[model samples]
Target: MSYTPLLQQLIEALRCLPGVGPKSAQRMTFHLLERDPEGALRLAKALTEAVERVGRCDSCRTLSEAPLCPLCASQRRDRRLLCVVETPADVLAVEQSGAYAGLYFVLGGHLSPLDGIGPEEIGVDALLARAREGVEEVILATNPTVEGEATAHYIGELLREQGVGVSRIAHGVPLGGELEYVDGSTLTRALAGRKPI
Candidate 1:
């Protein structure tokens, strides 16, 4: 064996994190054991606490310790604008942009029929129920992947049927991205979504 059983187990556990391959996990394990054992203890403590205490917000379905997340409970946010996204991380991204001052509805994931994930799995009924509670516009902020697109389209149609306005967050070349470096699909999306000043 390359490592002691406990050491190998630590490396394997570390690999569970996104983008952390075997070599990276091994390095992290070594760093934790040799460089900063105290930090490792803190990380373990925090992860355990979060797993025990954190849960989905009753209102938006985003991860939260309380029944309603801070964003859903905020009185200052615009109630008429509801931004629907695929995950908790997406909610953080939109909040970090500071361009949106409205409430959010986190879908937890997009529809993927092959994986047995569908409208019910992602809480479409809950979203529709939320929309009917006074939201005027639902901005679909789902990722631009095939599954994300399908999920958004499905939800958009349902929202429209209920008389709620639906819009999609534009997807294309990123800010400061060069045209030559951009892919054809992204370029096409950019062109299609362009607005005249």
Candidate 2:
């Protein structure tokens, strides 16, 4: 049995999403085709809108539909304190914890030499540049992974040279747990117990 060319193409494209395997892609295709045609159309429209309208925040580099993200635009957040994270999801995690009332800097990714991803590729230069502009403290909130550690150390050194204080978030976070997966209470405690780098 063969799927129509359009269905096969859609399934193949869906498989490109993170953690979506071929079987899952096929299941999703069939589910969408059989059960929820309107839902599928809505999903397609939302995906296209997100891809076309959303972009990186100019100040913090987090994903945004406007020129700046809500955090960047908010006067309530402490501009002097900056939390450097690997992605927008990290920022959201920290935000949900309600423990951090400071601004954020999203690196977008970690530095992985094996993957040919370096500092420049992940917006490290932009972060360093931001650090030079009277930033008081920078909390490294990157993931608890090897590449994430490398990125944190690199930024710490750069910020230190710029006369800005640098700190790394506590490793009390569970091993292999992404910030997005950790509960808000645990994340709050981690932020509260952060140590200097």
Candidate 3:
């Protein structure tokens, strides 16, 4: 049996979300209609408001509700140290770790030539401009993927030409992971980045 036009529309709209297929979207539509219309309304309102108000930070390119995000506005963060990340989510992850106190420059995405993403698409020139304005060190916090590595290397070269120090975040076996279960590349990186006791 076919769903009503309105219900089908809702299901189709819900499927626009990442990882949500037809079954998941239909489930969500039914759940909202039958169990929680109020919650669904709230979700819709929040999504509309966020879409209207949220924009990229002028300096860092991270999502923000204002011209500058709270982190960018704060004086406590180290201006000399900048962390380059592939996404705003990465900035949040690094912040949650409590190990970094630097400002951030979100690339919005990594380098993926096959997918048509390039230095300009990721805002590398803007990042370089930011680096020129008194930034002493840049820590590349991009993912360990090939695209992320290429993005970091490209940015490292740009920063080097500008006389700024650049470093990549270490990639290795996870903490508490046994060596036997670790992948070859990760194990190799872990050994390469090993520090003196």
Candidate 4:
């Protein structure tokens, strides 16, 4: 038998999430309806509020409720250094590391020519403008994917012309990883990026 119209609609909507297939969507729908109607309502309200209030930060392109995100508004962060990343999620990951004290420029996404995403679409001009405003150094923290590397190289060249110091985040073996399990490329990068102890 088919689900009631409302239930079927809910199940279909759940499938819009990444990695959520038909079976998972159906299970989520049933679980929410049977055990957590209140939780479901809360989730709906949160989603609605986020969709209504959240938007890109004026300066950095990260998600924010106001013109500037909290990080952009902070005075304690170093203004002379900027870390360029692929997403708001990457910003969060860097923040969790507590190793970066500089400001950030979120690209929203990497360059994907096949998807029609280019420097303009990802706001590279905005980033360049921001860099021109006394940013002395730019750290490219884009992911290690091909698109990410291309985006970083493009930005690096742009910044180099402006006399801004540009650096890429070193990619290599993870801290708890064994060298035997590390891929050859990662091993090569680790060797190339070696530092004096």
Q: 35 in model 1: Cα distance from truth in Å? A: 1.9
Q: Model 4: which ten-residue window has the lowest total lDDT?
A: 185-194
- Residue 186, model 4: lDDT of 88
lDDT of 1 by residue, 1-197 (tens): 67999999999999889999999999999999999999999999999999999999999999999999999888999999999998999999999999999999999888988889888999999999999999999999999988889888999999999999999988878988788999998999989988899
**How big is the positional error of residue 143 in model 4, measured in Å on the Cα after superposition?**
0.5
| Alpha carbon RMSD to native, model 4 | 1.1
Ranked candidates, highest lDDT first? 4, 3, 1, 2
Q: lDDT of each structure?
A: 0.93, 0.90, 0.94, 0.95
After superposing candidate 1, which stretches have Cα over 4 Å from the reference?
A: none
Model 3 accuracy (lDDT, Cα) = 0.94
Compose the digit string of candidate 3's lDDT tens values, residues 1-197. 99999999999999889999999999999999999999999999999999999999998999999999999999999999999998999999999999999899999999988989988999988999999989999999889998888888989998999999999988888989898999999988989988999
Regions of candidate 3 where Cα sits further than 4 Å from its true position: none
Give candidate 3's TM-score.
0.96
For model 4, how many clashes?
0
TM-score of 4: 0.96
lDDT of 2 by residue, 1-197 (tens): 88999999989999988999989999999999999999999999999999999998999999999999988998888888999999899999999999999899998889888989988898888888888777899999998777888889988998888889999987667878798898876788788778899
What does the lDDT come to for candidate 1? 0.93
**How do the residues 1-197 of candidate 4 rate in per-residue lDDT, one tens digit apiece?**
99999999999999889999999999999999999999999999999999999999999999999999999999999999999999999999999999999999999899999999988998999999999989989999999988999999998999999889999998988999898999998899899989999
